[model samples]
Target: MRDILVTLLVFGGLPYVLKRPMYGGLMWVWISVMNPHTQGWGFATNFPFAYIIAVTTLVSLVKSREKNSFPLSPISLTLIVFVLWMNLTTPFAMFPNAAWNQYTKVMKIMLMTFVLMMVVHKREDIHKLIWVLVISLGFYGVKGGIFTIRSGGNDRVWGPVGTFIGDNNALALALIMTIPLMYYLMHDLRRRWMRHAMLAAMALSGLAALGSYSRGGLLAIIAMLLFMWSKSRHKMAGAAMLVLLVPLALLFMPDQWGARMDTIGEYQADQSAMGRINAWYMGFNMARDRFLGGGFATYEPLAFALYAPNPAAVHAAHSIYFQVLTEHGFGGLAIYLLLGLLTWRSAAIIVRRARGHAELDWAARLAAMIQASLIGFGVGGAFLSLLYWDVPYYLMAAVIATRAQVSLHLGPERRYARPKPLGRPHLDAAQTGPAKPEV
Candidate 1:
């Protein structure tokens, strides 16, 4: 019953995003490439996804909590409990009403973060979301590519006025995620034409990323590509990477590309870096000053208004760690790092055990995607705030839920009765068995 609902929601966007690579990829076909509108133009926008997510979660929670105590990782539970604790213990959270509001707000994000992963319990659910991303983001990339070319290679041009969403970084990160998906498509493909088409789409997606002129995104995509290459253990793919960079050089080597590339050195010359250093200092001091909890999202604005150089330009701290610490104190930072570390640990287990078939392939593929998302979010968060974004947290939650599911299914001993080992066990072959990938 639950699986059916999840499938329906994912299938809602299949036709539109075939060529593009992100959820925002569907806006290209109907809306003008330059349309500035940002309303939900297709089926299952985030609002609807949120509703479907809510329904699916309630069902899963009710079913699981009623049936048996759902197994949870201590690392995940501790972090979640800590976040709740910080809000409850806020210094000025004296009124019950204020505390209730704060609790609800935190709960909202925490719940929203896990929606995708919670619904995606089976391997098929993961498959469905991959299609969702491919169809939605794929078509958007196609449209974006057309627009980028029309503008004489201006990478900053986002979507049509309002309908087309995604900054350059969003576009790039989406493409980075797509790389593994394409590899999977190729890996799973039985037809030559289908394999060719998937590779073509991958190329177009790369073009779209460069069109965004988002250097950080380009770098993030490169990181994911490097990960894929390292995992392949293939000499040809390694050589091809250098060959691929030639076309990219011609496309992005404009007057500003060099300066944009310098963003890699953000910690040195970038004002954003200096601001982060200042913000980190302030965040640490604030944590020492407010041991339990200081304030929620509302606190940062006040600090920026009072202490920042340009008070009128008040904004988020741009670092997830500092943002959580300043808002919820050191306790929040502890919880934040704990959750991330737990996720990485789980992902590592999955990656190490990824053999070559359906389940292990997914485990390995998702682990890489999660790793890339973490590194991208972490690196990008150094300059931009991602606390409010669903991508990072949702991916993290997926890692947790997926990890638990895979661990249960592939544990040394299955809980249920086991099948007798027939004449020769299928596990003998590296391709068919429990052997890990060479990576």
Candidate 2:
């Protein structure tokens, strides 16, 4: 049944996708983020749905005459440079086979992201794309939240297998990033029931993040909440809800959960934390020694033995910073950081320009929420080895696409192109100027 249903959706939607390639982009996001086929117990689990959709989307885009131009900006160029650098480092990788395989996956992600930039041009398209992402990730958020409540937060929340967010920490970070998007959707929605449902999803997603039992996730959620509150229009209501719900959620969790979280303060004594720190040191050593670094999958026991202080304790570069540092060297990390900083600045620019424009109000709100999401990734990512995860890049693309939409609405001269003063023109006409202006 699952196989049939998925096949039907893909084949049936192919016509529409061909007609409008953006639909295919949306489907790709759904498949990539949700990994719906992975939930099946049958042949669907092995189907190449995402690849089929991606190929179809690209083919359709090529055959069609739509203006599918890539957005050339600082962010996009930085991303291109980053991708090129990653490929350049792959040849020098310690484990060439593993590095090349990971490179292939990243290549697919970047291709789809650029496709998104081309097709997702309109306001409606942007909204639908965001909806796809919200629904895809929020499925886990709502499910995990209920599981956490039912299990008393004893078991951690994990994502579907074969997906980017398969681990508990990854799921928690994704959920934390999603809460702000949910809030934006709730406000953007018109129907009362829809808004209320989105509100429920937001609350549940927060609980789900807690259920992950990730100390980094805990910190990320705090950062997300702080930024959301600061950017919110109704500060009192946001604050009141935060004050009321946080303690209740904590009280509901089991003692084991609290005990696990307490390890954050005693990191030096915790094996996991110490392991991550050791990995960080090894990563630093690798980058310092090799200008191109060890490349992907180079965090092997041998590399650790060569660079680590305690050669016996080998660990993954659990930090994104360190992950990039070791995988692609300091140059790659710098480019990666530049991409993030530019993406963030792009979102901020949109928020500032869309502030007073009634038509672009949604853009402003979306940009602000996206900023919050990036903040979640930036903070939570420091402790997670999700350097190649595509979600953050997708957010960056959304930010760029949204800013473009707002710019188009504001016209070529942009927001400063105000209406000419009627009184001044009328006065000039009254003073015997050409009678072109209305009084």
Candidate 3:
């Protein structure tokens, strides 16, 4: 039955996707983020749904009348450079076959990310994209929240099988990033019932993050909530909710969960923490040895043996910063960091410029929430290997689209200028009387 439903939804939507490619982009995001078909026990579990959707979206995109030009900005430019750098380094990879395989996957995600930027530009289109993202991720959030409650937070919460966020820690970080997007939806929604539902979803999602029992996720949530509070319009109410709800959620977790989190500060005694540090050292050493690093999947025993101070303690490059440094070298790491810095600055510009304008308030609010989400990704990402996750790239697209929308609404000259008086405008000296001619 689940397989049938998923098939019907995908096949039925293809015609519409053909007519309006943006729908295809949204559908692709839904599949990639939610992995709805993966929930089934039948044919849908192994179906090539994403591949089918991607082909359909691209075919329609070429045929559609919508603007096909990519939005060129510092973020996009840096992304293109990073993509090129990855390709340049792939040939030099210590593990060529594995590097190519991972490169293929990352490139597909980057392609769809660019597609999203081109297709979803209108206000309604952007809102539709956000809704798809929220609904896709929020399903797990709501489910995990209930499971945590029923289990008394004893068991860890996990994401869908065979997905990027399949692990408990990954799922927790994804939810931490998602809470801010949920808050954005809650703010943008006009209907009271919908707003209330969003509020409930946020609370449950917070619970779900706690249920994952990820120490990194706990740190990420703390950083995200602080930034969220700072960006919120209603500071007092937000603070009160944090003050009231955080304690309640913490109290609900089991003793084991508390004990695991307590190990975060005592890294010397924690094998996992020591392993991550070892991996970080290995990445740094590899980048120092090979300018292009070891390419993708560089955490193999060979690389570890060559660079690691403690080669026996082999581990994945848990940190995003280290992952790039190892895979693409110091140059690639610089491009990666530059992309994030540019994206954050773009969001900040949108927030600053659109703050007082009622018309662009949605952009302001969304940009602010995206910043909060970045904070989650940045902090949680320090202990996880989510370098090419879909959510962060999607948020970058949202920032670009929102900034474009704000620019279109404000126009060129009027973006920063105060409104002129309605009375007769004061004429220039040349118009009012005599003026000197230019040389």
Candidate topping TM-score? 3
> Which residues of candidate 3, in runs, are more than 4 Å off?
413-439
User: Per TM-score, what order, best first?
Assistant: 3, 2, 1
lDDT of 1 at 356: 59
lDDT (C-alpha, whole model) for all candidates: 0.56, 0.89, 0.92
User: Per-residue CA lDDT of candidate 2, range 277-361, in tens?
Assistant: 9999999999999999998889788998999988889898888999999999999999999998998898999998888989888
Please, what are the lDDT tens digits per residue for candidate 3 over residues 248-294? 99999999999999999899999999999999999999999999999
**Per-model TM-score on C-alpha atoms:** 0.69, 0.93, 0.94
Model 1, span 1-439: residue lDDT tens: 4334434534564432232222212221112221222333443232344333344445544544323233356545765676566655654532345556766755665654443333445565455555555655666666666666666565564532323135566555555555565666566678999888887777666667677776666666666666666666575966696577646644554667556766766656766556666666666666777676456554455565544555444445666677777667777777777877877777887776665556577677777666755665565454444454444554555566566667766774235678786796555565666667797
Candidate 1 segments whose C-alpha is farther than 4 A from its true place: 1-71, 89-106, 112-118, 159-165, 246-253, 263-277, 299-301, 305-313, 356-359, 413-439
In model 2, the worst 10-residue window by lDDT is 421-430
Candidate 3, lDDT over the whole model: 0.92
Worst 10 residues of 3 by lDDT: 409-418
Clashing pairs in 2: none
Poorest lDDT segment (10 consecutive residues) of candidate 1: 24-33
Candidate 1, residue 345: how far the Cα is off, in Å: 1.4
